[model samples]
Target: MSVSELEPGDREFERTPPHDIPAEQGVLGGMLLSQDAIAEVIEVLRTADFYRPAHQIIYDAVLDLYGRGDPADAVTIAGELTKRGEIARVGGAPYLHTLISSVPTAANAGYYARIVRERSVLRKLVETGTRIVQMGYNADGADADEILDRAQAEVFAIAEKRSGEDYVPLSEIMPGALDEIEAIGSRGGQMVGVPTGFADLDALTNGLHPGQMIVVAARPAMGKALGLSTLVPTPEGWTTMGALEVGDEVLDADGRPTRVVAATEVMHGRPCHEVEFSDGEIVVADALHQWRTSVAGVTAVRTTEEIAATLDEVHVIDGPDGRVTKIVDVRPVASVPVRCIQVDNTDHLYLVGRSRVPTHNSTLALDFARAASIRHGLTSAFFSLEMGRNEITMRLLSAEARVALHAMRSGTMQDEDWTRLARRMSEVAEAPLFIDDSPNMSMMEIRAKARRLKQQHDLRLVVIDYLQLMTSGKRVESRQVEVSEFSRSLKLLAKELQVPVIALSQLNRGPEQRTDKKPMVSDLRESGSIEQDADMVILLHREDAYEKESPRAGEADLIVAKHRNGPTATVTVAFQGHYSRFVDMAQ
Candidate 1:
């Protein structure tokens, strides 16, 4: 029945999220006549982010015509709708013209679009919140951790659906900061991080203060070790680093075979390996303090020549060792990978990274979502666009239990394996995580589901299996546009929920054409908006996939290619494909 046709409260039992019909009409009406207004309206809302079906259809027409670089007025829009046979569907041509006459000006089109978006968000929140309340009520009968995660996820989902945060005045913020300081003082503490446990550390920093992040990082070896087992290739033959002792032969960076005359002590806290090449330059390799951070925690850096590359190669003859090479070791450059995780005052959005098939990107996504729920005690929701629910469960079980994926799949688990799996089963059963392996799902469905989940669970994080697979609300002319719209919607979803959305992405073979074969931001398959809309992009590069002759045979690179809020760098990780898991590359 038409809502307007009914008397007030005729269907009092019928309930829905809030909406304004005239507002929707006014927005469409404003854009239907003005070509200039279409640009402004499109920025604020997508056709599906709207509440009503007819409004969505009308907005889609406006966007489609605008995209084609055609003029969009009421008459042209009606003609286009008629051509597509949607004229009667959206109340026909009369309704189209009726919208134009309804709006006083096209200038408020953006404002009207915002109103539609706001209503849509509000409605989703109401729907999601009710579901969360029901979940809470069922908590006594349900698994608490799972229910809590779902409930938290649902609430957070609603929070994320809203955009922007109100700025609190310093007066409002400083009192809390000062209160923290006062509490520390009352506890006989001098300052926040002002004095560390160690006296030496306290002297160095005076005190670890507030509003700063301290990272205690594990080191990754680079430079001095890329030539591991040093059967390093030369024109003569493959020679080991140890075999080529003092006065032994080895190849230089330029492929020159030269004798190593002298190995000298260089310096600490610097790339200090100084190996002399007879009648040539000395190779000074500063091998100290080499480390790189990755998405999967920490792992070894790629090359021993990292810091040594900064040095100038020079030939310097000294003593009776004849003409020899000397390496001028240079200090290395440092990178700031991620920022401090501020409890309440900060926010982060991330693109977990990219991968080729079988690189275990999905496994990494699972680990990331699990970490949010388990380690940080935050609720997480995962949307698996590819794998089914049971398969994902097995993988999760394998990862959580540290059991081989093959064992879990084959049901040939040993005694300890079963014990471990049993112990973890309870933990896994209780973890506040929600997973959905719905196939061919649309973005609108994801939003509604996520909002519902958030309302019930207070979900702090959301993960979409992959971007390209997400169904768009409407058929787009170009595949790029379709994916672009999805990417934009995902961004809005993250912002609306006020949580990180780790959406896995598949990379193009562009990485395969290069020697390094590292996925770049450009390698993101179809849409340019994938990069544009994302706050951060982490690219996964597995060297073993690229080369049979690499020490990185067991490793993958977590390349932070685009970080809108922080630094970008590459770190290493170990992908245990059989377990469907990833871990910090162990030393």
Candidate 2:
């Protein structure tokens, strides 16, 4: 009978789990022979990953020495073991010499480490299976669903352990953290993480850092949508959605020309709608298409569907001269092919149709993701809980190529835009920026995916667009509790991954109630834990967003309300709404 058919007490089932003693010896020997080998092997095989007890002790000693910037050869490793009174337990110094002699060459240390790690994983699988079998036997009256979930958790635990979630001594972390701080200081206070592309903000917060949860909160209508087939204004002239290409230049919400950095392929069979304005202008778009509107003096970006819900409310259209227009009617239209594009403007808006009506683009997370990958050459992962992957990609492209998002969404492009995209395409394409637009994900799922990305890509950054959309996976008493749980879990995730996590958040109506209309740390919706969990909190404020003709029309305030490691200050940044990005005010 095959192994699966064998009983629990069968001889085959009692056999030793998978392991390779020779491979473990080879790895230990290589590490002893060359200090460089230690660096390579350590990443693949942790101390517990070794099959033999002696090897585990040896591995730990070697790592301790290495972390302290000391030698890890036979003599040093033996001395380290001796200090812990474990020298004899690890077969003494002579065993170390024997290991060095056993290895032919240290050059294949990584290969040897892989062999050891593989066997360890197989051994873990066996252990996990045994535990699951026991659970099944003992789960007599327990809920079947609970037992199943417990079994699944047991299986997934292997992956979690392999992801380096084991507790580490403070000794191992302080060196790296201090070294990083010193390096930043050496650079005369240069940013230590992904650059925000805004100098003052970079100086204030030291960039969007790793293992951090950055909250960019604002009132509604701050950003995003567009469908295909909408006419868009361009420097070369107006163009149909189907005619637009990457690198095409188009006018932004400010009526300034910007390039299309990214454009999506035609999406067919989308539910379409026709929105009519008071000026007798009609634009055909999908329900997801966004429009800049003002209701009772509160200007915000609203989707076609949202606008349709309140037909009686006066909707003010986007205009440079502060002209207000009302929505006459919104009716469903025939399904049609739709396209989307993103530009490099900070305001992330562009004009559509002859009426010069303005529409929106998305967030700052894509900009940080793009900067981390293309500018800093670091791998980054963006978890877009709201937008789709295509839209996220287009936004990144827009930020990188200095193109306008609305222009690209409407498929309005000019030759200059294409040329600009061409210049940046190679960098953008090669960037280690991974986008996952999976919607309504739980924090547990995000952790699992982020762990995998961390292992495979050496992921350095994570950006989650808005936190409230995330679920706690299990049922909670209230939304606030769920959000609070997510907030705490996100902090743990950042620490576990050792990378910064930028989680976009929505502020409560507290900002709208204030005359200044500035958000505070207390405004983080649904949870007080969000304020406690975040290493930094950035409240995004634009005077022009509240006051139509303010003197600071194009300026944004990045209020660093809470900086765990540094001083909190408000950094003024230029809101290049047209280019879909933020720049230093001097720019």
Point to the candidate with the largest lDDT: 2
What's each prediction's TM-score? 0.44, 0.66
CA deviation > 4 Å runs, candidate 1: 1-359
Give the per-residue Cα lDDT of candidate 2 at 228: 54
Cα deviation of 418, candidate 2, in Å: 4.5
What are the runs in model 2 whose C-alpha is more than 4 Å off? 1-13, 23-45, 58-114, 128-165, 171-190, 222-361, 389-398, 403-406, 409-430, 471-475
- Local accuracy of candidate 2 as per-residue lDDT tens digits, 237-300: 4576678788888866434578888887777787787665433345667888778788877989
The TM-score measured for candidate 2 stands at 0.66
Each model's C-alpha lDDT? Answer: 0.58, 0.73
| lDDT assessment of candidate 1 | 0.58
Candidate 2 local lDDT, residue 503: 78
Assess the local accuracy of residue 478 in candidate 1 as a C-alpha lDDT between 0 and 100.
75
Candidate 1 Cα deviation (angstroms), residue 413: 1.7
lDDT of model 1 at position 365: 71
For residues 1-587, what per-residue lDDT tens digits would candidate 1 score against the true structure? 78867877665436755998888988998888787788787777755566778878888888778877888887888899899998888998888888999989989888888888888777777777778778887677665545655565565644555432346568546756888768867867453332222233333343323222221111110122222222333334344444445655543322234445444332234434433222111233435433231212223342335534633432121211111112223323332111111111111111111111223566667776665665555677888765667877887888878896656644567999999889888778788889887756877778778777767787677778766556654546977898887787777777665566777776654665566655678877767788888876767666654343457656766676765645666666776665666677566
Clashes of 1: 47
Question: Each candidate's root-mean-square deviation in Å?
Answer: 23.3, 11.9
